[model samples]
Target: MTPEDLAPDVLTDAAAPIDPARVSDSLDHENTLKKDFVRRVRDCLEAGESDTVYDLVEPLHPADVADLFELLDADERPLLAKAISDLMGSEVFAELNDHVRELLVESLPAGTVADIAEQLDTDDAVAMLEDLDEHDQLAVLAEMEPEDRAAIETALSYPEESAGRLMSRDCVAVPEHMSVGDLIDFLREGHDLANEFWEVFIVDARHHPLGTCQLSWILRTPRHIALTDVMKRDQTLIPVLMDQEEVALRFQKYALISAAVIDEDGRLVGQITVDDVVHIIQEEAGEDVLLLSGAGEGDINEPIRESYLARVRWLIANLLTACLASFVIANFEGTIAKMVALATLMPIVAGIGGNAGTQTLAVTVRALATNQLTASNAWRAVRRELGIAVLNGATVAVVIGIAVSLIFGIPRLGAVIALAMLANIVIAGLAGVLVPLTLNRLKADPAISSSIFVTMTTDSMGFLVFLGLASISGLVG
Candidate 1:
């Protein structure tokens, strides 16, 4: 549904309305949900006034409530959940952060979690259950209805992050034999159909998707018109095993509001809507940025041990790469000692190169993720980066050259460092583009590996070039 569809202060009649200003402030800023509100809720919970806690939360949108849950401490969640058990619904669960949701689910009984699963769509239900331990998963599944359990089981069997795990089973599908009138009547009469859908799928006898009929078309067309006459035969179908990122790209490329997800046999099993893909896009964008920094998952709700393990391994890897720069500096130890200026000026070279490399790395990784860069245009991408580097290097060299001459009172020393600066910047740009491209070619995650190699390349080269230039130019002596 669109943003215009929702009421600002309240969701339903049963939900006690909250101040619109509270929602407005929360929506406008990164963390506008004030501590005072949280403290008030805590006080209510502490005093065993569950009704007060419920009264405060009942009016907010499910998304807002989800945000509120994030603002609360982990210990406060169960208390809040207990205070508003009836008010908590599928919408709130669907809007929850994955890590936070998992914690809450773990705290609840298998049956309670199963009941929440039942309230969500098949894909969301699978998402909520798939993270639990296998034993716990079985227990939760056993507590679910046979139909819901079966759907979740099948989705879990597909690889994680695949379209099968991302698509909702709650879609309306009709045989092409039906007319508009028949389709409309079925939709009005069917009790088990999805409550929220933008369009309906038209299928053939084999249950393979043949076309799609948007809700608008159904309303506009005459009742006697056959489904095929109104349906758009051209549709983007997602393979069940296709990665969710690719699925989201397809949705964007086609401007599709919804698409059918099919199994290997070409029978439609589920559907992916724009709303589901929006979450995937946001998650992937954020996940990649965090991975680039070696910050695992970057979720506050992640277990401490898991966060430690994720970061420590990358730190160990970084230590090894840092040694490469140390090795370069070690070879020039005598030169540096003889001319203290060489030691003083060298860090500037490495620091600038590292920053340049990072700039290029960010752009290249983003291009690759967006499908803007690939084998076909990789050479062009490299050439474009090189041109940018040359310009950037020339600009940086002039500024540093003048500064060094004024600071050190040596024009030749300035020239020597200037040349080194230009060379290192060029190398930085090359490393930034090449490293990620190489990782991508090797079937590794470019975002995860690119930064380390790029940083190492820039650092090692930065030291090597600057020291070598000073030694060769005899400016240090």
Candidate 2:
């Protein structure tokens, strides 16, 4: 209809003042999902104005709304979910924090959860159910429609954190024999296609993925060309049993938006999208860092008892290592008694060495994780670390040497400590690189317990070298 034929009051309706309280500022660059928005939603909920709470949150992105769920107190999550039941779509659940999502899911009925699972991509649906107990999972699955139930059940049968568990079952795959025109027409006529796909997998008669045809290519190339002719032959296929972290690395290295996931027989079963890889990358990166500190998953929403259990066990292990350093100190009691300056300067040696080791350890673990450090080239990595250690040792030794000489007015003491510092720092670098590599060779995670062992080595050796030199040189006595 022409503008004149439209409703006479359209302009007036368009110009109506926005309700300040109901306005969604989610799109405004400045109006981020901060504490103020959270407080307003909380206030609205507390006042029993569930509709107002919904209005306040309706403008947020699914990820932002998920963040809002995290921002809420645990008790309030269910209340807010009740208030925004219609708004709690699959996207919101997909983006929700694992802990928060589980809490909400547990509060939901089996049928409702099944419905949500049905609405989500297979990977996300699997993630939602992955944490549930066998009984709870079965209940949810029983409530689901048969097709979705079968897809989820098959995915759950794979080991957790594997490509099979991470991939989306709803992929767009077509026979290789079709022409580009035929593929285009089929895609246009298909009603049950995946909501999101970057490329269409070209498959053989046996349903084995042969290659991929990117959407950009499909749209640009002439329709008369055979699908196999225009499709890229060099496509990365993810093994179903491959670890999720490896899956992410492959995505990063290959710059892939989506890759076909294959079974043992090399038959295409599902696809892993880049969006899921992003989550896996973030999880693995954080997991390694927390593991280095002996901290278990280090999730804030973790129960107090669970957090304590994860952290305290490591602290106890650290205590045992601390005693080994103490044993070295006890052996040098006479040396410290003769010159109290030895007592004052020993900790500086140990502390700095520990820090140096930690720096190297972090780098080594990351390189190993990214496949940058491997058996054939490990020696090269070691030599590079040794060079860095030498530079670090020289810098630290010179500064500490000058300070000791000036403060103690004993050149021999300074010389003893300077040489000791150099020895310990070089030892730190060696231990840092060697420990993680050893752990990796043993098929253990390099990040886990590496920090503790590295600290112990630095501390014990720091005490041994400094005290041994001080005793032998007769600088203190």
Top candidate when judged by TM-score against the true structure: 1
Task: Give me the runs in candidate 2 sitting further than 4 Å from their true place.
Answer: 1-31
Predicted candidate 1 versus true structure: per-residue lDDT over 1-477, tens digit per residue: 221211122222254557887556435456445677778888998898988888777657887788888888887888887777776677888889888998877777776677778889998898888898899899999999999999999999999999999999999999999999999999999999997999999999999999999999999999999999889999899999999999988988889889999999999999999999999999899989998999999988788999999999999989999998999999999998988988888889999999999999999999999899999999999999999999999999999999999998999988988898999999999999999999999999899978999998999999999988888887756
Q: What's the C-alpha lDDT at position 213 in model 1?
A: 93
For model 1, what is the error of residue 449's alpha carbon versus the real structure, in angstroms, after optimal superposition? 1.1
Look at candidate 1 and give me any clashing residue pairs: none
User: lDDT, candidate 1, residue 106?
Assistant: 78
RMSD of each: 5.1, 7.0
Locate the minimum summed-lDDT window of 10 residues in model 2: 5-14
| Overall lDDT per candidate, in order of appearance | 0.88, 0.88
